[model samples]
Target: MSELVDLRTSGRTAVITLRRPAKRNALTIELCDLIRDAATGAVADGARSLVVTGEGTSFCAGADLDAVYGDTFREALYGMLQTLTTLPVPVVAAVNGPAIGAGTQIAIACDVRVAAPTAAFAIPTAGNALAVDPWTIRRFSLLAGNGAARAALLGLEKIGADRAHALGLADRLGDLDDALAWAAQMAELAPLTLAYSKQVLNTVFEPELDAATAAELGKSFDACWASEDFAEARAARREKRKPVFRGL
Candidate 1:
């Protein structure tokens, strides 16, 4: 079977590509599981940095609504979001096109985001008879400011790449190549320092977020520390060799 997501490594950087262009890279349950597995695997492989981007015209259109309406599906979606937040390495979302609904959520879960000039972002959940999770509401408010958050949730406003950057939703305006270059640069840093730095920065932002929300996000970090990847990383440095993580 074809892989739902594609993963490749260059030096210490892991690039994860969302491959379902036919669906505008809409996130399905299987796709979410693949992403979570890839993120965990990249860390186990001793990757210092990670980049997530789409295969074609869209970064992600959003969740597969067909799968999200059911109660069981909602639980699975929540679990996937929890998994995404805990990636050990720094994650950069290279947004090449539109990012709506859950797509916006995925991008926000990353540490940083770089968007192409063609990229656009929106959250239209209100009209769809859906409400964003409490954690998402709080995080979006903190990240995009209360006004923008309300406009997104209540007004269903769609913001373009440039405007999104201006509003702080995207950290930079760039294409996929630029994002890859940035990831490569980040990969050259000392691993321990980078990990610790991410931890400290997360700590600073943790307070602005809801306590329950922040705790759920911390689960990924806790899993990382307890995984075989952590031990392999330590040994790889001592042996002057690259780590081969099993994602255990």
Candidate 2:
């Protein structure tokens, strides 16, 4: 329904594409809303599985700088990521190219990822003196192991598609066509089985935690958004220079 995102179904598989190539499929507030809507709408439209990818040479470059520094953006982004993470139908990521920042989040949110030759992933939060929530960090650790997680989040390493597949970050490496075929195959399986399996996996490692830990994690991540380093990073991007993070 949204011009920002295009949804099309193929053999019971719904494919959602981020359609903004000019900005390298960067996520805006409106785009985030459309992404969440597309996921829900696909299920409502009889889709048994879902695939997400980008329109051009990128899966997603990340969130638009202008929209990513505030609480509104964080709330919207978390909602979309959370929805995709817990979607009833299996969600696959057809990672066409470089997926950075929020783009990385979208890919990891999916139940499976099939990457193209050009596909690469990075969070680069530390490079900007920023941070992600504890849940996201924990998920990355679980998916790729503590080594890769620390490298990506702390050392600012970018993982190529092949290495990602080897690290268990990506399930496979292929084009959009291959990803769609995989989605179709998944769609034909029993829906309830997939749903239950997904739920079980999600909860298996979820620890019953205190409210204080949750609050602390939230505060630490939000604090980065309002810091001088965040502003420095934005300015550096606009000026086409390396950000000199002061850790303030």
Candidate 3:
């Protein structure tokens, strides 16, 4: 496993921590792949519940924009998120700090979220002329609310911990220890019941996309990644200037 992703077990609860604090635990292709592997390993090791958190102040700033525009990166990124969502064991997100862009997606992928006072969530894709997948939009809307989703995705506003909990985005307001305690408590529950409930919830709430809709969403998503604005956003980041997007 990559050193960027750390996995360990606490009793029957597995903990996965993103370890690159210098970068605010931003997601990269390697980090995403490692996260999926770690989750799988935890399941194989008989973990009954899981908690994901970052090692430093920031839970995850987002995807590394420098490497964000590409098929490989998107595949790894969505694959990890999907894996966490489908994992039989219940997963909890310990949002220790800011969870922006892909970080917000990571928190939503888990079954529940525990946010620190400093925790905040945002997806500023519109500002950069980039876009998240359809599932991200739907999952976020379902967990939070259409109003909150619009505020985050369209208004580009950051939702803080108190507001997040009030909006139903964060299930609770607490830190890493609270998340672990919740996970540990979940580990002692009836495994089959939890698994079945999770399966039902995912399936009922998020049905499979039809082929035509899937294709249309895919084409639109690919266009954003291949757009000039996406490149400009990355370049502007490197230049330490604001990105001026042209809706190409």
Query: Across residues 29-124, which tens digit of lDDT does each residue of candidate 3 receive?
Result: 999999999999999989999999998899999998776758899899999999999999999999999999999999999999999999999999
Query: Which candidate has the highest TM-score of all?
Result: 3
Please rank every candidate by lDDT, starting with the best.
Answer: 3, 2, 1
Model 2 per-residue lDDT tens digits across residues 1-248? 66789999898999999999999999998899899999998898889999999998999998887667587887888899998988889999999999998998999899999999999999888876667778778888888889999998878999999999999999998999999999999999999999999999888875645799888877777788889998999899889999998878
Candidate 1: the clashing residue pairs are: 86-220
RMSD of 2: 1.4
Q: What is the C-alpha lDDT of each candidate?
A: 0.79, 0.90, 0.94
lDDT score, candidate 3, position 201 = 97
Task: Tell me how far candidate 1 lies from the true structure as C-alpha RMSD in angstroms.
Answer: 14.8
Clashing pairs in 3: none
RMSD of each: 14.8, 1.4, 1.1
**Whole-model alpha-carbon lDDT for candidate 1:** 0.79
Give the runs in model 2 whose Cα sits over 4 Å from its true position. none
Give candidate 3's TM-score.
Answer: 0.97
Top-down TM-score ranking: 3, 2, 1
Each prediction's TM-score versus the true structure = 0.79, 0.95, 0.97
